[model samples]
Target: MLAAVALAFDMTSVLALMYPGRERVEILGQDGVTYVYACKPGPAGETPAAQAAKAQAAFEENATKFGEAFAAELMQGIEAGAPTLGMALDMTRKTDGWAGAITAHLEKTYGCALLG
Candidate 1:
């Protein structure tokens, strides 16, 4: 589940850093890590973590878009040997691996994701 946790951070960072006017942006690489978060003090002068505080607000405002984007990612393989961790994470959180509020909130959230 550590992989899932790492991927989750990268996923949220990738989405939060998306340029508002971008027509298209590449979030994750073939290695399953998001390139956006890997860069240091990027062209925009803001680190990915610098924007994390507003992520929940952004998602709340664009819930539909967020959900769609998330579903799209779920259809693709994010890690080697793990076609997708959606089911695994879901099951794990329900079983002995539950991690408390964070997992619970994520499981209850409803939103759509936009690729662009």
Candidate 2:
């Protein structure tokens, strides 16, 4: 029975790798495990490390509900300072009831609204 189970698992792994059009979603975690959140768009050129950092920094800055692990990874992304990652982190920071802060910052810094 154990042998059969192992064989089944092996076959499933092989099939998963062989299948075409498999969507690979990257989950940024802490200690390389425990997902905090998932970002779908703007992942093409961004590394997992970068995304993790961004998420962490935003979490810290906004004191959002994101868990500790996620916040750490996001900090790494913020450190990298990649354009897409920065935008994503900023957007997330703007959320979590920080819209007022974001709007004021945008207006004060750029002379316009964050959305307008």
TM per candidate: 0.20, 0.24
Local error of candidate 2 at residue 3 (angstroms)? 34
Candidate 1 per-residue lDDT over residues 1-116, each given as its tens digit? 35544443445446645534322223443345442322222235544343322333443444455456556545543433453456567545544332344333432331112222
Model number with the top lDDT: 2
TM-score of 1: 0.20
Q: Give me the overall lDDT of model 2.
A: 0.43
**Model 2, stretches more than 4 Å misplaced?**
1-35, 41-44, 64-116
Q: Write the per-residue lDDT of candidate 2 for residues 1-116, one digit (tens) a residue.
A: 35544443433334435433332233344445432322222335564344444554453454345345456656776677757756676657645446576445433432222111
Which whole-number lDDT from 0 to 100 does residue 68 have in model 2?
55
**Each model's total of backbone clashes:** 12, 16
